[model samples]
Target chain A: MNESERREAMRRGPLHGPDLTLNMRSDPRFLTGARGLIASVAEKIGLSSTSCAQVALAIDEALCNVIRHGYKKRSDAPIWVMVWVLADEGVGAGLRIVIEDEAEQVDPSKIRGRDLADVRPGGLGVHIIREVMDVAEYEMRSPVGMRLTLVKYDRPSPGVEPAAVGA
Target chain B: MADQPGLNVRMEQVGQAVVVTPEGEIAYTEATQFRQWMRKAHDASPERIVVDLTGIEYMNTPGVATLVEALQSAKKNKYRLVLAGMNTNVRSVFEVARLNTVFEIVQTREDALA
Candidate 1:
């Protein structure tokens, strides 16, 4: 679905599960606490250890981008994060995280990661977020700023068949 | 020496090489201090520099970026750079960025020194 459609569905609470919402400044010092909280929640939701860490890392990268690129290193700017479990999907359980910022809006299409072959710093955050999360969507907020949504699906252990729906 | 609430970095000379040890999660919050420590290690003008990642259980892109910056400087300045003792999670970040091939990585601090 498109971003507006997804936003509408989220407004209607289409996904049902425990959710956590956070409102904090763009200060990097708060990253450890945020990562720990999300990692704990991911673990409780049955994601593998590696997946839990990946999810936390993805969220951390998103927050860092907001602080660095969006807010331009303004530590006091606001950032909002929402994480929820997707329990109703036919696929295995999944998690969705939404990060919102009120910084200057930019063209989402222009936010591409730099070439990895060049081997440089600073462009890897976007690449890491895309690599770790199943879904990475970006959209401009209503008045200003940007919103990013990241989703990850739980995979069954290696060599084990996924449980049949309702089984 | 560089110390922050979530991260600590210490530098020491081991023979011809300087070993820099950073303990704790190296995220965006600790990137500045980490970079500063690395810069100081470079300025010491050792023939080789080894970053011991044994104490780091977690590292984000910013931390990796700082290391990349150090690697570039090491190349330009004609000093060898080695990374050692990365935990699985920390190593995976390098693997994901396709940086595993770009760095001189070893199993332990002793290996780096050798």
Candidate 2:
């Protein structure tokens, strides 16, 4: 969607309370606007600027991976993103984002990004998502595609264990 | 080839280095054009190549990959690829990827030119 449409869609939301769902075409141009929307949502929910920026970047990486790996660079593909503020004992109070795509089912077990020590341009998106988010999980849908859920707590939840991948 | 519609890349020669500055978001749509521009910059075969990232507000994996590809080409061509003027947001992308060390990052174009 264009920036105006995306902004208008955001304005139509229950933005302050909780949860905003965005339906966007797979085109990468929308990402610039998408990150802004996410950061706004994150800030509105009382997240610090640093945390909000991290959320935006993490989500950016997630969506980028979806476009590259899930849709295989098809500009016309569909990407559905849902962002919400939630309170969980594990991660405390923070944001939760769910991204869904209609691409072929991907094995979550193999979703690990390459080792950072290797030092490459690609494969860092997944690593960024995992690092910024307290919890990240990928689940295969029954019929097709995959759903990725990522969460970031306000403070580091060192005691809270991360969910196993593909679980 | 026509310049990629969404991305704007400006190039100039400074001493022995070629400086390429790309403005606007470098995402999937502009990936091809960005790559092509990088190839053209390398084709100039200068002793040093500097990419000024100050104008870029947003960049994704494709953008980073394009730079990585340029780094690979720099190695094969025996030229130096230096990145300068990275805004905090764009620089974080490189840091999160642990490429802050792999790349020769400088604070300003002057440093890169030096």
> How would you encode candidate 2's per-residue C-alpha lDDT over A49-114 as one tens digit per residue?
778878988888888888878988788988888877664545445777878899878789989988
lDDT against true structure, model 2? 0.80
| The best candidate in terms of lDDT | 1
Candidate 1, residues B15-95, lDDT tens digits: the string is: 889999999889987889999999999999999999999999899999999999999999999999999999989998999
Model-by-model DockQ, in order:
0.85, 0.54
Candidate 2 docking class: medium
How far residue A149's Cα lies from its native spot in candidate 1, in Å, is: 0.7
Alpha-carbon TM-score of each model against the true structure: 0.89, 0.83
lDDT (0 to 1) per candidate: 0.85, 0.80
Candidate 2: segments with Cα more than 4 A from true spot:
A1-18, A88-93, A158-167, B1-6
Predicted candidate 2 versus true structure: per-residue lDDT over B27-88, tens digit per residue: 66677888888898888989999999888887767788889889988988899999999988
Tens-digit lDDT track of model 1 for A1-167: 66556444544343554378988999988888888888999899888899998999998888989998899999999999888877745446667788889999989898877888998788998888988876787889989899887877676311223664246
Model 1 clashing residue pairs (backbone): none
